[model samples]
Target: MDLINFWLENLPTMIDGLIVSLQVTGAALVVGIPLGLLLALGVQAKTKAVRFSSMAFVEIGRGAPALIMLQFAYFGLPQAGISLSSFAAAAVALAWTTSAYTSEIIRAGLEAVPHGQQEAAVAVGFTRIDALRFIIVPQGLRVAAPALLGFSILMLQATSLCFAIALPELLSQAYMIGTNTFQYLPILLFAGLLYASICVPATIAVSLLERSLSKHSA
Candidate 1:
């Protein structure tokens, strides 16, 4: 009853923090996925400069830990004269990480596409850009969708790291509440449940979608 009462009292604050976490995740995905697709293509480009630049970006994003990325965004950037709010910093770091990781997934999907398709597109009077925009990108994105969805779930959990930067995300809210109440265990567990509430459903949905896509493809 005490635990229940505590949670009920704090639910509003937790939910508010959860909303901020979701907003950051959404913002990151919105920016990252497109950048990911472009990086996927850029890394495969014929131009050496483009390919190298994209490769470097992907490598750095992947190599750095997410915590390091967030810290750099929130703390380090201001030293270089780039000031950002905590939310903006969190979004930027997560987006960079997402773009790097998703670029590989997207690239694999792009590569999985039949080479003959591109040939046929060119043979049928379609310009390279038109063929890619209309056909290749669509197919590649469809192939990558399941993996992308799964990654999004991971990103939602990763948003907890924003607590380090004082973003007042779910974990941050829970921590503040714990500090006030001195009930760390129950509060942290509640935060974990909140994360699971979102991630579990998303994970199940991604699995179903993947199975459906595979069935159709097969």
Candidate 2:
């Protein structure tokens, strides 16, 4: 079929783009999730300044659109005497977004752990930090893992937004191919399928993870 032939012809270029996409997603997760955990803790800190600052960051990151973040990183920062390549800009922006969103998810997970557990840890003479480290955070993060995995999948899809900044990600590659061949539909469809191939499996894995966690907890 024409579509199959078209895909075969373009597969190598698309694969290259996909590798970049995966790299970006991996980098974002590696940096962002830890930052998110810190932000979640900061929001829960007793100090008003720490809490407020954390809240402000989370609000701004969550409030602005990811596209705007990407644009600002790539285009806006140069005006302020800071410059980053498109790949660096995209990674930084996406990481910020990931941290902001995942902080809330992580916070909810922390809260979901019962107060009784903290008390039990304290009664055993554990310091507050130890209680959190030994009792609260571990369980909370486990509870949050599935949701975080799901979000990572969403972020992977959101890498398409980087195309606007001229990152040679999957969608960008497809667009370039389409522009050259003037075969928009087939190329775009192949791009869609490529995204689906990753996301669909990731989604199913998250579901399985959630079920397994539920069973383990029960």
Candidate 3:
């Protein structure tokens, strides 16, 4: 009861940190998704060079841990005269790492599009680009919706990386509250609730999208 009351009293402070968390998630997604799609397309390219280069980039990113990536961006870049704010460092690292996984998701989505559909689009006098933009991508995204949403949820959770860079996001705020009150369990519980509150809706929405796509196929 005391913990609940304390959290309620400090709701405004927690919310302030939550805003930063959302900002990090939103910004990373905005930057990462399109880049990921492009990377996916590159991976699918007919040319060997394009495919190999994209594959290499994705492999390197996926091989490294996100924490190491975040630390590199925050600590290492300054030596190169590129000083980034904690928020910026976190966002870049999240976007880079998430893009690698998202690229794979997108590539699989693209491959899942029936070859017959692409041929049908071309038969109707649509350019290859038009077919991809219209028929291929739409179906691919529908097929990929659940996976993409799962990735988004992962990205949201990964925003906790901001704490390492001294960004006062949700985890950082919870840490501060825990340190001050010496009530680690309560602080962590509230943080977990906050994370769940953000993720549950996203999961539900994605599940609905997947179901709808399944019905359309049926």
Worst 10 residues of 3 by lDDT: 9-18
Identify the runs in model 2 with alpha carbons over 4 angstroms from their true place.
none
Q: Per-residue lDDT tens digits of candidate 1, residues 45-156?
A: 9999999999999999999999999999999999999999999999999999999999999999988888988998899999989999997888888899999999999999
Worst 10 residues of 2 by lDDT: 209-218
Q: Residue 145 lDDT in model 2? A: 99
For residues 1-218, write the lDDT of model 2, one tens digit per residue.
98899999999999999999999999899999999999999999999999999999999889999999999999999999999999999999999999999999999999999888988998999998899899999999999999999999999999999999999999999999999999999999999999999999999999999988999883
The better-scoring model by lDDT among 1 and 2 is 2
Model 2 score (lDDT): 0.95
Better of 2 and 3 by lDDT: 2
* Candidate 1 lDDT: 0.94
Between prediction 2 and prediction 3, the one with superior TM-score is 2
Cα shift from native, residue 4, model 1 (Å):
1.4
Pairwise lDDT winner, candidates 1 and 3: 1
Candidate order, lDDT descending:
2, 1, 3
Error of 1 at 11 (Å): 0.1
- In order, what is each prediction's RMSD in angstroms? 1.0, 0.9, 1.4
